[model samples]
Target: MDPPEQLALREVFTAACRAQRAEVLATAVRRFASAILTNLAARPVADLLADYFKPVALYAICELVGIPATQRAVVAESAETMAASMDGVLDPERRAAAIGSRTALSRVVDSCLRSSDGSGVLGHVARNHRRLDVPRSVLVHSFRLLLSPGYMSVATAAANAFVALRAHNLPLTCLSRDTGVDELLRYCGPVQALGRLCRSDFDFRGTPVRKGELVLALLGAANRDPERFPGADDIRLDRRPNPHLAFGWGTHSCLGTSTARLVLSAAFGRLADQFPAAELVSEPRYAVRAVVRAPEALPVRLTRGSEGAIR
Candidate 1:
């Protein structure tokens, strides 16, 4: 997973993610977000994490990966199990369950690729990328890599952003702009750290890191560094020149960054316009996970705005 091989694999994944088709992805996101929000609006009090954000994130990624509708429930359940297992990495039972879930997800991806008629991202990659020399196993793993974070991270970030904004009494309107969204991403992004294997011995601010060792860049801390971001402790929706590492930095950044942004914007924009009086029913209970910081449950009560529901 080094150099040309890694680069080749990334290229294939990038293509499979429809990275070049921003408009297509945006449309798909809006469609899914609208549907999820419609359901959310029906409930007087709903768990936003489970009812709104998670459903939107799950549907968007499933559509992108070309997973059949009938199979999405199983796929989403397995993916959630796999993500939650990270918190119990030391427990043998959880570890075994994670392995089983991963295997099951890979099999699903294999089936989708085999039966694909070259319609969606998975189909396109499976049908057209045979000359890349990437292993089938690697490709499947790449899809899992895309699926897991694409769902968990995006959903978590959206949920976290809601809580953050509400706590600050900031209107959801802030999310309408790219700068506001980026600031929320910097402040409430779910990824707490980025782990990288050192390629060569190097000095990190007087600390020596050996080659072949694991180095964790603390992204959460870096995003809040006062030197890099003025008034780093506060949420600044108007923060400019904000070069946040919420999505990591350099070549290894999250592949679904743009997709995440589109999903968030569509989701909050629809919410703000349709349900401007939305309020929290109760304080959100945070999930106690290893890497991702998100709510276990976000209870919210929605009231329709003058504009009415999205149709």
Candidate 2:
């Protein structure tokens, strides 16, 4: 993506956040949680992620971007294909698929912008595109970015948070306090690590680093470091003064931190409240991706008569 495109995309999110357009994100969270309940109706329990969260996240993203339901599957497939290329481990066939999907996704996003159902972040951007002077390609790239990480991260984070809550057997009320949520975010480390290029020579403890070298900050390890966080190995529900960098730190920290927290808290909080007896039927099967890590399957047995049935 070119600088202009990047800037325009940045503006879209920054502007949306500035306008306090969190209601859309909140609705998406509720819809995601409801999907889990819907799946439970068919089966006593299902893969919390694959069976429910994935589809819900995909649908919620489309809803957020004004992508019509009719075109959602195609758009979603394209976005997924494109995202698979991000870890830079694509074979020739996969590379070709990524390129093709990028083309298709760009076209689909262009169509949506032209005739949006007229709502959500995309709608706001479309209405202000001329004012922002953002190019069609820029908007398309932005949509792709939003659809992939913007959706996947929140869904995966919520699932992981629930897993932590289950492991610790903590109550939903714990998450009501900000400290509880912070510890959850720290313990989960959804993004895992961030790669940074050294601009100048630096020394670490005893080892020396050269300029222009790539270094991966292992956020998950850091968050679990006992030195920084006492009893870090244990999931302290109300771990306070937590300086965990789950959302990354410094200049390029995640822009969606607040939104992500709200989504996770709302989703998991409801799950805990509704299915207090929900128990894991099997171990979580995680995706093998190194860059962004989350469980592919989280099988759980839910209580038969849960209060918060999807209405």
Candidate 3:
């Protein structure tokens, strides 16, 4: 998208995800996270990614985008299908399935817009669609963009965080602080890279890039750059002055940054406070995706803690 159109659409998303809406989403996330953890605590073992994190993310995004409760299950299924297709980028069958799923999702977005009653992000866009400079199709695509990352990316990030926590034997409480959350985002962010098209020719330390060439920013590598982040290999929960690009930088940054942060912070903070004794039951099975790397399943055994008893 051109700068003007991008800026205009971004304004709509920004308004939808402002402070007031974020607080409401945060409260909902905390409640949902607590309930999920409590239910998992009752089970001998649970797939944290499938049962807990995925559901939490699905609920948050659906609510944020005004997906009706009746349609959430269908949306979640399509979203997962789309996420699975990412790993099979080379396979024609998967690509076809992804296209089908995307179309289904788009239809849902259209439905929401048609029935919009001034609620959620879809409502905001629908009400102002006529006034916006961008085409209606573009707005619909943008809504799809919002849903994909808000759901899949957030779930994957949480799973990655748990993997890191288990590997390092870090206390769940580490996620309670903003600094710790930032460090977690740096170390375990699910987005492996950001892809862009070069608009103009440029040189990077002698390497030249021409206009229209594809450029990939390796976010995972940059986050671990030893020169930029001292002891970058280690997960320091309280790392200060950590300016990481886990979320892409500049104008094309992730549109749901605020929403993702609120969900992660609330969900993890609730886990830390209520289920400190949670442990991974086995090695996580990762999904096959190059762009948004995350575990397909995270088996966990939640034990009762002194502070938060398992009921």
lDDT of 3 by residue, 147-224 (tens): 887888888888999889778777777766778777988987988876789989999899999999989888999999
Question: Candidates' lDDT values, in order?
Answer: 0.80, 0.69, 0.80
* Per-model C-alpha RMSD: 3.1, 4.5, 2.6
- Tens-place lDDT per residue, model 1, 161-200, is 9888878878887788888889999997888875789999
List the candidates' TM-scores in order.
Answer: 0.91, 0.79, 0.93
Q: Ten consecutive residues with minimal summed lDDT in candidate 1?
A: 302-311
Counting clashing residue pairs in each candidate, in order, gives 0, 0, 0
List the lowest-lDDT window of 10 residues for candidate 3.
302-311
For 11-75, candidate 2 gives per-residue lDDT tens digits of 66668655645776676667667756755756777677766556666665666566777877777
Ranking by TM-score: 3, 1, 2
Model 2 bad stretches (over 4 Å): 1-12, 23-32, 35-39, 90-96, 131-136, 172-177, 198-212, 304-311
Task: Sum up the clashes in candidate 2.
Answer: 0
